[model samples]
Target chain A: MQLTSPDFPRNAAHALHDAALQRALGNLKAGFPGKRAAAVARLPEFEALRDLGRDLKNHIIEHLDYYLEQFEASVQRQGGQVHWARDAEEARAIILGICQRAGAKTVTKGKSMVSEEIGLNEHLAAHGIEPIETDLGEYIIQLRGEHPSHIIAPAIHVNLDQVSDAFHQHHQQYGKHERQTEPRALMNEAREILRDKFLRADVGITGANFCIAETGQTVIVTNEGNGDLTQLLPRVHIAITSIEKVVPTLEDAATFIRLLARSATGQEISVYTTFSAGGRRAEDLDGPEEFHVVLLDNGRSQMVGGEQQDMLRCIRCSACMNHCPVYGAIGGHAYGWVYPGPMGSVLTPQLVGIEHAAHLPNASTFCGRCESVCPVRIPLPRLLRNWRAREFERHLTPQGYRFGLRAWAWLTRRPALYCGLTRLGARLLRWLGGRSRRIRSLPLAGGWSAWRDMPAPQGRTFQALWAERQRAAGMEGKR
Target chain B: MTESTKRAPAAGRRVALLATCLVDLFRPTVAFAAVKLLEDAGCHVEVPVQTCCGQPAFNSGDRADARALAEQLIAAFEGCDYVVGPSGSCIGMLRHYPELFEAGSAWQVRAAALADKSYELLAFLVDVCGVEQVDAHYAGCVTYHDSCSGLRELGVKAQPRKLLASVSGLQLKEMEEAEICCGFGGTFCIKYPEISNRMVSDKCASIVASGADTLLAGDLGCLLNIAGKLKREGSTIRVRHVAEVLAGVADEPAIGDGE
Candidate 1:
């Protein structure tokens, strides 16, 4: 939760050279995209559903207050409480207060990016309570004392050996000694260790994918059934989420559910799509006694009706990051925040000040792959551009790049000057190319020359040659 | 879309080449190749007095300059029946000019008009001109890199490939991850060189694994980037624009090649 976004360039350099991290990212490059493509192909209506999802989320964001109020009323009617947190600190304090009131010695958590954003684990640990991450990736990263490199795959930066090392270093507390190399053994060991904690935990915490206004039920979909146990087995259950996750009705939620799993992991539906309302009734065999929902509005309310409003439509399916080549290259930790990739590039600036996370928005190829794959159709490239515009307006851009851009723009306004300068520049470059016809390095563009040759410019500008040919042909045309 | 039996457009369609800044300064052969292809398609071609499409400024968040350049560009190409260009990235910037202006302003309307008339070379050839094949050929096995702008923005995926099929001896050996970016993102490569290097390095690796002796793409920026990386890696694979190959204009040295 420390703001390391300013160190993005350095972090990116480190990630690019980290052999183990690169090896781990290789699996991601091959794995998710193919599966998502096949899943999307199998569902003929996927594109139409994406449109529907976008429209539905747009509607929800527009009528956010109404649906959130309706959700709160629904939760109250179902014998549950809704707690509002204006920011991360407030959210952490509210959750911690609930844990303290419950006399919780330990609490189990499912994978929740909202929790990460709020820095809830450290907040709770700063007090006397211990929090256990139930999801496999989350548990691995928790043992390693690292943040989730990715939104969905928390420990995606960690390889199998790294996982073995994490468990080897940390699992001794559970009376387990051997370092397990196989994934199944690690999973089994984690499950055996977590089962005891799950049974003994006084409170359970989880992040909601959706909180439906109509039914007062919060939804979470997971493959390992960790969420169901984390919420069901504990004495008290708390669902922590951001305000934008609220949807008007189950049908609207269904439209997104159909899009989410396919976009995230290529599953038709995750193995467990658990929906929890208020506390259990007499007929319930296994359920919590107390239920609470905490909604965090950390700088989100200010984004309404702005250029970035579309970002609220994100379902955290992470389709943007998965499809992004930049994310593919450097992985997520380089982003140096809880959110990473295209969504992070846009949102990190909004959440943490743009000045703190300037590189997040500036470091993109604008390939539009993130926007292409977004389920809710967020225009991530455009949004990133919006940040660039803001950064430029605020003069947050680095001075040298800004000056080069400024000088380039100034000359573009003067046709004659631009033409003259380009003609001379072309000849200079051609001469620099000498015989090989490529410059190994450039004066100001060291970044480009550091890795690739600068292709030599043709001797003359196209307009100059065309005009000359036209004159030779006795064609009197406008110059 | 490539039904060659279908009739071509009425002859003498007043198509003006935008001659993107890259083609104007870096590789004028691409513009000439574009002129040859358009003239062969029964269209009248004219080179417009235009330079940069205002993308660098627009992308760098300097809309003031982007709009000023956009205004000048729109005025310069006012009467052309269609504004076509050699680079999809620049033409994509043209298509996006409307977004740079206010919603219903006069500048916005004109920007939209220019955007509507613009087309990338390959898409214009196949879709509008109805040209199925080009009367050109080369013996080398070649791979195509789908520059992101042309592929995603203008739907140029099949246009060049369809035309490439009609060449006499150019074998289109497809490469993996052909649709990925080569990382010459105008200002992006310059600002974040290391990341761009990583991306282009991966792209070069894929091009090598495809085992093609030649590389062709619609946009010169990506071609230059890939060619530069390939050359730096000491590979002999040649790079050229798709238009150059289609118009019989690739007789000169390959991009980034000499002596």
Candidate 2:
């Protein structure tokens, strides 16, 4: 939530050296992409479905105000209320007001990145209301007093031992003090502890994967079903989501859900896909008595008709990060935000200004794996390049880098001068290497020569050799 | 000597070899191998007076300079029947030049025309020239590293492998995650060397696990990066450009190899 994106380089270096984090990141590389591939291979229409998802989101974003108004009327028709917050502070205040009105002592929350973006937990705790994370990953991270390193998998950077230790330390008061080595044991312990909190909580808040304008329904897909209990058992239920989540129809929600689960976790469908519309009906036996939806704009509306419009189509499935090698190496905390990876690289700059988050866009190899795997076909690499262009245009890039690029470009524009200089440089490098034919280190290239040897040039430029060959062939023809 | 019957085309086509800046400065044998392969494929090859492809600037966010270099490149090979390069990364940059210009502008039109005529060497050979195989041989097991640009940008996964199948005794052993980047993203290796080093280190481990005596790749930047790491770690695996191996001209000493 805080703007640590400026420290991305330092964070990446730290993550690279953190052995436990590296081990956790290894599982991400080995696990997600293959499952998604197999899942995609099983469906012949996966690409077509991605197209539909993209088109549907594009249609909604183009006419967002109309859809939001329609969604508001639908929610009001179902005895629910809609609140619009222009930014994070407004959204936080709106949620706090609802909790205060309900006289909530404690609140349970499903996994919501919007809440993290707004620093919601800290705000509630400051107001004397206890906020408990009901999602398993979110709960583990909350106990550790850390932010969600990853979007969907909040505690992905934490290893099994770390989780075991956290649970052992945190769950001792619940009379389950021994450290549980088995994952299922840990899950059962968490379930037991959270069940009590779920019953006592006066308010429940969750994030909606989709807000269906057709039926005033908010959809959430989770494997653990923690979201259902979080919203159902409380007296007051609130859903906090950004405006872009609103879709025109349930069929569009179905189309996106088909891609979201497979792209996120490689499941054809998550175990629990719950759809809730407003509060409990008069005929309903049990449900929340009050329902509210908070829509946060938070600079998203400005992205419409801009270069970053495609980024708004993101389903937050995180397929881009799952396939990204840089993320596979550094983990998500290095991104230093609620979102991470390629999507984060493009979106973080928009939310936090480029001056604070420039490194996010520059930290890619431009391998295009993110774009290749994106279900919505967001041209992620091109968007990153666009960010770079903006960074350059604003003169936000370092002076040294700009000068170096200008010098190189000036030299490259002149073929004869460029060829002559490179020929000399190549010879000099070869001479410096002597017979070893590899430079162990060089000035200004310590970064490259740090972990690898720089191979010496072949002592002659190709142009010179080609010119000699052409001359010899011309002489032979004359003879 | 016969695995299958395929022959080079009769000579007629004029092909310009845009030897990338790396080949022009660091490794000329790659350029020579490319010329040999093209000449053998019944094409009259000419070396254009070309500099860098402006990818470094384009990628570094210096579009003004990148466009200047792109315009220079467009003028250098204007009359050639086809523009081919040994490195897929540079060729991909050529293809992307059109995107750098404003739509419907004259420069954009020129960039688009140049992009249409450009091809990476292996793709040009197998796809355009219809050269089924090369009259070359290498008697060792070698694994190919699919550089990201060649593999993803140009769809060049099968072209080199398809041609390598015809080499007399070359056993193509596939490495795990071969398509992953070797982290020689032009300026990327220098700018983010630690992360780049880790990626290449992972790549080297995969290459070692394949039990191949030699490593090959389509892009010289990746080849150079991988070779540097292998040499630094004191591994015996040889590294060379795929064109050098396919042209039977790789005998000059592999990259980073000498007394």
Candidate 3:
């Protein structure tokens, strides 16, 4: 929840040293993309469903005020409360106020990236209220006192062995009475510990994947069923979600659901997709006494009229992250923000401003896998470039880069000088390569040549070749 | 080469080949390769007086400057059959340029035209030209890295494979996470060296695992990064532009021609 604009140097150092994190991240590169492809192959209507999903999200965002009003009104009518928080501080304060009024000593939470975004737990704990994370991944990260490296897998940076270590240290406190190293054992131990917390917790906080205006329901999709328990067992339930999570109807939500699970976890549907409207209705077997829906704007309103409005349609399925090579390498931590991967590359800069998050946009190979896999079809690479454009406009970029670009631009404008420089540069590189035919190190290029050899360029430019070929073919060349 | 299958339009397509700064300078052979590929695919490949694709400007966040250059490119590439490019990144820019400009502006109209005909080589090969195979062959164990723009924006995933599949004796072994970025995002490698190093290293490791003698990609930037890493590690693998492989001109210059 506390957004640390991670300095790239420090984050990269940590990512490099963090072996457990690497192992966990390695699993996602193969596992998630493979599953997603298989899932997409299964659904004949997948592309149509994606278009519907995009349209529904776009429509909801276009008329967010109406949908929010409709959703809030329905919640109020169903004996629930709705709070609109202008920013993270207000959202956190509202949740804290709810906890204080509930006389809540302990609060159990489902996996909520928005709550992480708002820094809800740290605020609650500072006020002397205990917050227990019920989701297994979130619980692991919570135990380790680290941020959720990934949106879907909060503890994606932790491997099975590290989870075992976390359990060994925390299990005694939970009275589980044993240390477990196997994934299944660790999961069972954590599940047993969280089940007790679920029952004893006075309040529940969860994130909504989608909030249906038609049903006036906040929907949560989870594989572990922790979200359902976190909401149902507690006397009071609070949903913290961004404003863009709203959709017009249940039918719209269903279309998104068709794409969401496939994109997120490669499942047809998450093991549990629960929708709760307000609090308990009369004759309900088990339900919360009170429900609160807190919609937080937190900079999204600024993006609505701009070129970046398309980003608001993200369902946080994280297919982009799973498929991203950069995310695969450094894991999510190096992005230095809660959202990592292609979405994070674009969104982090927008949320935190380009100066703080500038390195993120430049961190892509522009492989477009993220866009290809994105259910809502956010053009992430272009959006990232837009952020870069903003950075240049503000003069926030480093001075060396400015000088480099200026010189390059100046050279490019003059064909004679441009060709001369390239020919000379190529000759210099080829010379530098010598008998090895590869330059292992050079002053400015040492960074590149550090792990990769610089290939000697062939002396002539393509323009020269085309001109020669045109003359050979007896065509009057443009030049 | 096939006959031009003109789609219904009067906006009159005249495509300028954005022969990428890399292809133009280091690998002019690729530029010519792209020309042959595009012309064979049916569009008149024009070499406009263009330089960098404004990616350097765009990525540097000089939107106004990038827009200026983009405007110039739009003007230069105007009245083309289609603004085709050999590089994925440049083609991506052409295709997505309208998103950068105000809709209904003169620049937007030109940008739209530039994008409409602009195709990364393979996308132009299969999607535009609709060529199933070229009369070319290179017998080698090769693996393809899906450059981000070609894979995503242009949907060139199957086009390269479809063409490569026809090459007699060319074994195409699929690399793991072939679509994952090589992290050679132009300025990215220079700006964030540590993260970029990590990414490119992973990419190299995967390519090495494929036991590929040659790693092929549409984008020179990615190949340069991966090849640099592989070469630095002293791996005995060669990196060739997809065009070079497709043109069947990748082998070390036929026995003693230079000698």
Candidate 4:
């Protein structure tokens, strides 16, 4: 995933000028948040259940080393292989090794963000292995050759017309009939096209929402049954997930499940929520022949035993993004990464150095909506602020801005100097804002005037008003 | 000062008001409004000589400078009954200070004390101050925007509405996506103007759909954002601080109007 966040003015200009993106963002009004409210309304103890979920995740993250060992043992006992990768390179290498050993012709994949994080598709294609996305949303993006915008709804940024064109172009080549532009029609076409690929594929890869330490089961929740087929039908099944996604017990997993669906899609449960423990056993009628789990610790281990450890408790529900004002307008593309939203803001800066993703932390309005909606109650705004702090302390910020901040901070600490400067600034503004009642353009504030007029500050500062009122009251008392 | 005055609320029950830098400078009416609201509910209100809540410093990555401000704030509000503020951002800063300061430092104990009692105005009114309503009246269809700090950090969602609903002549029309952010964000508007403008534009559109003549919110930063957009777009919809609306003292015409 790309880690660059373009300059504020440039990115803002792009977001404002993009009319199509505006229309795309309109769907958020009735999407995740609306569904979540209805889902929460169904349960009397949703808040209590959230507490349970948060506690469960906290416990797992705290005892992560213990749980990982336990999970590995259980997976081995059940005839599945568990691989630990210290970083993206090792993870990608291990996956390619699995595919090469199997002599895979084609691999069908369910929607897995970990795959995107590791750049698996690109890596596999470079190594001469064909990987096809079977999930409806993933398939749309695959045809268009674009990245997933939203975590859950991968093709959220793509409208029906664009999808219709993709299907019309790809369906005939894949020996499937072209379909109507409707969402259901698009899904049906993709499902029909991928059905045979799923059966013929030598290997299948997926992302786990949670890995149960108690049973060595990788739990996945999906509205469509593609995840089930991707893991079951293929001879070789590989689950790729971050090390943070571990839970102590099935009961703990159940607690998080209550919050996960409600937060992500506002549903009581997804259409198909399946749990696969290990490779196919003798009694199992339908299961993958070989199962492998790759637990990737890509800069996540460092987050433990620190102030940001709470962030690891996230269930990847995407609720924070849905309710976030900054994310709502720009869509996920502006984030320039796989994870886009408040969680992405903090996580991206850490995983890919703050210098590259500096604009992400600066993207927020510090509006607390993301934190309020976060299932784990992560203090997202503060975390983003922490990233900004690191950026400054490391001298990663632009030099001009650093000097300006120093000057401002110097002036702000002293009351007399601050008041004097503010008075001068106010008089200057009053002079500049004569008669028209606005500043059309200013040297320092061009970004502000670009979109809307900078409202002129009223002549007197608050200190002046307060002082005058006090003097008037004193004179009245003397009289 | 009489001992009865000091002892009535008790030492532990004494409340300090962190008049946010914005409240102290831009809108003191909101601060006085908060004071009246707290005092009316029997919590002694103390306006401490607090500087900025370290938000600008903290957000800008000047943690060392932010620590100075935090240390000063913790000292100023030390041994107070409750550390309350009209601004949600200030309350948020207060609550999160323990994590910033060293554990065994003098500032940490003060920060913890401050955090325990730190509540946004509405949350203090509803929870600590035990205020259900403020017996006020206003004639208009008004919609409320939940400010991020107040809604998420302080959990002050229903408190402001509960106060507003008791006003006799006030008619509340729920806005579509009322909980969404208006995107003021202090320096964020200037920093990311296009994104900010687009977000505020979306918020303004939702306010228009609710058809409420007036817009009210807990945080001034958001009100300023929405108000600026409304004013720039030449919309007549009025924006007011929720305290002013709840106080029932707003008789003047809204922005761009003569009373």
lDDT measured at residue A417 in model 4 versus the true structure, 0 to 100 = 68
Model 3 lDDT tens row, A55-97: 8778877898899999888888899998999988999999999
In angstroms, what RMSD does candidate 4 have relative to the true structure? 3.7
Enumerate the candidates' DockQ scores in order. 0.55, 0.56, 0.46, 0.39
- How far residue B40's Cα lies from its native spot in candidate 2, in Å, is 1.5
lDDT of 1 by residue, A25-88 (tens): 8899899998999999999999999999999988888999999999999999999999999999
Model 3 alpha-carbon miss at residue A85, Å: 1.3
Place model 1 in a CAPRI quality band.
medium
- Candidate 3, residue B165: the lDDT equals 89
Q: lDDT of model 2 at residue A159?
A: 84
- Stretches of model 3 off by over 4 angstroms after superposition: A174-177, A465-479, B1-17, B35-49, B79-83, B99-101, B125-133, B166-169, B251-259
Better by DockQ, candidate 3 or 1: 1
Report every candidate's CA lDDT.
0.90, 0.91, 0.80, 0.79
How far out, in Å, is residue A66 in model 3? 0.9
Candidate 2 lDDT, B38-116, residue by residue in tens: 8888887878898999998898888988998899889888678899999889999999999989999999999999999
Per-model TM-score versus the true fold: 0.98, 0.98, 0.91, 0.90
Candidate 2 error regions (>4 Å): B1-11
Docking class of 2: medium
| Residue B75 alpha-carbon offset, candidate 4, angstroms | 4.5
